[model samples]
Target: MKILVVFVVMVLFCDCVMTKECTNTPTQLSSHTYRYALLNSKNKTLKQEVLTLSSHDHDHLTPTDDSAWASLLPRKVLKQEDEFSWMMMYRQMKNNNGGSGKVRDSGSFLNEVFLGDVRLDSDSIHGQAQQTNLEYLMLLDGDNLVWSFRKTAGLPTPGVAYGGWESPNQELRGHFVGHYLSATAMMWASTGNDTLKKKMTAVVSALGECQEKMGTGYLSAFPSEFFDRFEAVQPVWAPYYTIHKIMAGLVDQYVFAGNDQALKMVTQMADYFYKRVQNVITKYTIERHWRSLNEETGGMNDVMYRLYTITGNANHLLLAHLFDKPCFLGLLAIKADELSGFHANTHIPIVVGAQRRYEVTGDPLYKEIGTFFMETVNSSHS
Candidate 1:
């Protein structure tokens, strides 16, 4: 999860600014009230009552409320205006003459902004950090990383599996491989290092083989029954969260390193979940059933939203919406300041996904929810 957070922080770095009115607002809940509300929020009966989405209307994705929030925070920060890539391409906006200039495709904002274009100064702290990160990325043993994956596929596991989280007994055994793929992909893109590219390519190839061996769209170091545990609402350590990391890593590989096989693997993974989610929603309300498990889904919504942008598949778009947690987001949809006692790390990624949703769908509700959450977090929680 730390590595996943590192990847998220690297990609979604933004400046948070709050207005005086927002900051001065008395929105903070008392400790007692927070605890009471938190417990009540977890009430299964009450959740089913309010959180269930009975309507299968496609309009659910498009919120009816177009009312603007009172907050004045901006929605996005252009890359050209930022320090990291000041010279990078940006979407053309209106000029001083009130005329819109030639605009770039919103979906391809970073298409031409290759990381290799920027050279880090070796003496700087960022450069040193990059050097350390690059060395660590290269030092990871590919066999050790994929050992559990091979074992799960009935392939001969030649190398000793790493202890701790990567242990074969661990539910999150294959998650690090995803993180490694993302890091190496980004590193190769940034440095134009042939060695890193080759290493990442080999890993992607091995993962592709594993995916084929499993004979399902699923590809993980653990058995598929983990998801069965997830669907059963039994004790399980965040199967979807691990899958999100894997999907996000494959996405990074395809986007950064231009690996077509990575794209195919991730699309298959999405299709697998799309069908799985379809099966689950048929029995019960998506909101109540999925949220009732109280599992950490990581950025499943965000990754799916990303996949939709790439493939433009309607199923991919709908699947992204399926991962949205209405129990929490429904509160934000109504401008409720009820984030107290909610798991911070777990839900923050939901907001990140909301931002991506707004980008892909042009849904005003998503923008409002994302903007309000950011404003609320900056004003009070931070």
Candidate 2:
């Protein structure tokens, strides 16, 4: 009888695991489905809720007055802004005319000005660029681009070597590669340098190959197990911090150098990231592991938001929302100065993410939160 009971218990356990695996699969939304969902009744209700919340007189209202809140209803449609670009410049031209001093012309009030190739054809700028390019070339090796990825995957390190700040012993071993990619891509764009463009392409290709070898859409100098350690509140360096840099670098390459491969790799990595985090972390779990976030995670939220804007992928938008640190942001929302002993660099990225969220979603709460945080930081920390 005891042996029979044991067999039944094992069978039940296996069945439970299988059921969970089946349920964990993410729903794949077709483009048409995504658009339909965006325009559906559910989204309209959400928009109404956002508007009501934004216009609510929170100071005068009591928490128990649900009827009062419901009576406020909703009004106004939100406007969407264009994706931010550094090259796009805008300045408000003051009108000195006698007629009410208000600029009537669309070109007079605020206008976009094109600054044509400021980085090119200037001797001083070219000299500085040449010096920086020389230093970058000295610091990096085209062949060793895959060294860290190889090491993480338990494979052999190939040709040349990573040294200086990106040496294997360094805590930030994988960070410089991302920074290098961004710098090279921007330099190529500014000066139309074929050599720089070629180098950027090679590095991106090598990284893509590394990602393929990992076989899980995961690419990093360290394994995904680091995130497990992070969730467990065990001692580990900032894995997401490193990941943000890599994602940002790839995005820069795609945007500036027009490298499609970089975009593909980043989207793949983002999918893997979303699945892992959604499966592992929940609001309750994140609250429980709040102390783990004391370490820097960089601007994971900011980059994810940018990715969403680029691809219009709901998954990326969801990922961005998930990275919000409620403990910090909650305080900021209430205009509390809770940043007394916080790491300035670590928290600043989160505030910037809030600002980006405001721009993308047109949510006034995010704008308020971001503005409050920025004001507090400028007044206190600055």
Candidate 3:
């Protein structure tokens, strides 16, 4: 029975490649004509045919006169070899208004299944467990959850902080507050508990106050210097990872609890990171910037993509694309199973981000990355 359950989970995770169709399709009009040199003209013709058929939109097509084409096509191509042509296509899509390039039907997200629509039997074990969880969520003191945040933002700290992970000196002190917000928001939706929603809404309101005090669109238990260390490649705990949790929690509050303030706060947080990442990329090459992803970043890409779905902000979408770790994803894109030495759990969230990216943009490479990673991890690493 356990094996069967695992198999079912694997199948569902690995085969989730399709998405919803977009309503607004971009009008792709190409003006340049291709004038290929006679030498190896046949290969160029084949390449042109391949590009033309890559997508319905010609906007993703590389300019025929561009010198990059010379490097893309070798004289003799292997029949079944994948040159990762989709990478270029995705780049073009990204450049044009942050990958909102009329998503192919197969890559857009299906209609969302709201938690409010679900109901479990009251007497069932699952239902009872949910009730117990909701109760616990309410019992948690909102002041305690925001203590570190208040202190970080120089606001008056009203409640004693929790020990262990929530300790003042803990690098991951405030990560749990984000988790708490996410749980409360979800519980409110699942049970339609107005009390629970009101409590979590107050928490969101408190966090918003903390964010305003900080005045940089940044809100974290730790100092912003953590990110400075993160970008400098110095030793620091997972700052971006912690930030991802907070951002995700705010998103859940907005999505499930309908807290507009939560959305406003999270969008500000995304904007903060957008400028930060762009600065790093400007100071150094993008490849150099990717090296900073060696630390655990949790699901930064996942939350950013989720945020993009709601706000449709180009910077949010750009930030989502930036969080993708190409070194790991590039290998998975090619079906390579080199998950031996890396931390197993750290990469799972990254794969979730890839899944969300595929859902948003319908980029086949992200779909391939997600599917291949799931299959490899389940079969070999399981």
Maximum-TM-score candidate: 3
Question: Which rank order by TM-score, best down to worst?
Answer: 3, 1, 2
Per-residue lDDT of candidate 3, residues 206-254 (tens digit) = 9999999999999999999999877775545568878988999999998
lDDT of 1 by residue, 1-382 (tens): 6544542342234221211111222211212222223224434553243223211111122111221221111234223334222111111110111121111146743455678678789899998999999898888888788899999888888778998677887676788888898899889877887887888898899889999998788999899898876775554556887899999999999998899999999999999988888887777656435443245688888999888778877788777776776555655755668766665655778889977776666555677889999899899988
The C-alpha RMSD of each candidate to the native structure, in angstroms, is: 12.9, 18.2, 16.9
> Clashing residue pairs, candidate 2?
none
Ranking by lDDT: 3, 1, 2
After superposition, the stretches of candidate 1 with alpha carbons farther than 4 Å from their true spots are 1-112, 284-288
TM-score, every prediction: 0.71, 0.66, 0.75
Which residues of candidate 3, in runs, are more than 4 Å off? 1-110
Candidate 2 lDDT over residue span 133-210, tens digit each: 746764567668658767886777777557754556544567778888777776776667676677779888888888
Any residue pairs clashing in model 3, and if so which?
A: 19-106, 19-108, 20-108
Candidate 3 local lDDT, residue 129: 94
Predictions in order: lDDT: 0.67, 0.61, 0.71
If both were scored by lDDT, which would come out higher, candidate 1 or candidate 3? Answer: 3
State the local distance difference test value for candidate 3: 0.71
